[model samples]
Target: MDSEVAREQALDAAEKLFYGRGVQAVGMDAVRTASGLSLKRLYQLFPAKEELVVAYLERRDLRWRGRIAEHVERHDDPQERIPAVFDWLEEWFGEADFRGCAWINSYGELGATSERVVAQVRAHKRAFRDYLAGLVTDAGLADVLAGQLFLLAEGAMVTAGITGSAEPAAEAREAARSLSRAN
Candidate 1:
């Protein structure tokens, strides 16, 4: 395979293993095996495990946010768009391999030991919050509503992950609606 394809294959395997199991639990050889790439090529693409972790995070962040944005954009009503965020979350939580927020999971697994992991988590979260803020602004809601919505969404992810239920997304959406009305 070409270098770019090999790189993508490595990341695909790394993301699956890292997110499915704790990052520390999976070894490079596992990624190598999963990707069907040789050890030398894997190392050539990612010099260290930390580099692989970073790449996994970076790709997941972009892909996750893009999916959410696309989902939200499907709705025409501004008010509906806000709730659409939770709607998307609900669908995500229902997936067979649902594993909660990748950033949150990554932080729990490796943030203390890996500053790169810590930075990636923080950056992803900050960007998510900013995205919420944009939605709040576009909806002509109070500025504070942005923070509340962001918290609601994060809380739903954690709750769903812990309890193995997708109901939190709907619950959060109701709360967001109530808060939006109060604003």
Candidate 2:
């Protein structure tokens, strides 16, 4: 298979197995079997299983942002967009395959063993936080308001993780709307 096509297939399988199964439980062989690629092909695309996880995470970040932007484009108001953002997340949280945020799951799975992966996860998180922070600020919320909304959003992710329910995203959206009244 072509490199891009091969990479995509690998990522698709990784996402399914990683979320449906745990990251640590799924190994390179599992991914190789899932992707229908030869062992050599899998190794060529991903030198290590950790490297594959990082690639999987990078792909998740792209798709996650795309989900947010898809919802946001349907509305002009940033305040409206904030809840819409959570709406998308709510859908994801409800998915049976969604154990939690893949990136976050990977971070916890390989914390001390791999500093490189951990650093990448932190950067992804920082970028996410900053992106939402900017949106809050743009919606005319002060730094304090922005911070509060950010915390609430992060809390929603954790709540979903802990409870395996979509309620947290909806609650977070409602709370974000209330915070919007501040602007």
Candidate 3:
């Protein structure tokens, strides 16, 4: 396979392994086996597992945010759009391989020891918060409202991940609605 296809195959395997099993739990050999790539090829593409982890996180962040943006854009009203984020979360939580926020999970697993992982997770979260901030601004709400919404959404992700239920999304949406009105 060419570099692009090889890279994608490697990332696909890495995402499944890293997100399904904690990042530290799986080794490059597992990714190599899963991707059907030789050790030489895997090392050539990734150089290091840390590099592969960064790539995995970057790809996942892009896809996750893109999906949420698509879901939110289905509504024209800002009020409706904000809640649509939770609606998206609810759907995501119900997925067969859902394992909470990948960034959060990666951070919990390796943030302290791995600078690349830490930076990737922080960037992902900052971007998410910024997305909510834009929504809050569009809704004509105070700037602080975005932070509150971010907290609610993150809390829901954690809760849903732990409890293996999507109910937290709805619960967070309700709390977010109350925050919207109070602001």
TM-score of each: 0.98, 0.91, 0.98
- How many angstroms is residue 114 displaced in model 2 relative to the true structure, after the best TM-score fit? 1.3
Write candidate 1's Cα lDDT for 1-183 as tens digits.
899999999999999999898788999999999999999999999999999999999999999999999999998878788999999999999998988888898889888899999999999999999999998888988999999999999999999998889999999999999999999
TM-score (C-alpha, index-matched) for candidate 1: 0.98
> How many steric overlaps does candidate 1 have?
0
RMSD of each: 0.7, 1.6, 0.7
Off by over 4 Å in 1: none
- The global Cα lDDT (0 to 1) of model 2 is 0.81
Decreasing TM-score order of the candidates: 3, 1, 2
Question: 53-92, model 3: which lDDT tens digit per residue?
Answer: 9999999999999999999999999988888999999999
- The Cα error of candidate 2 at residue 59, in Å, is 0.8
Angstrom error of the Cα, residue 6, model 3: value is 0.5
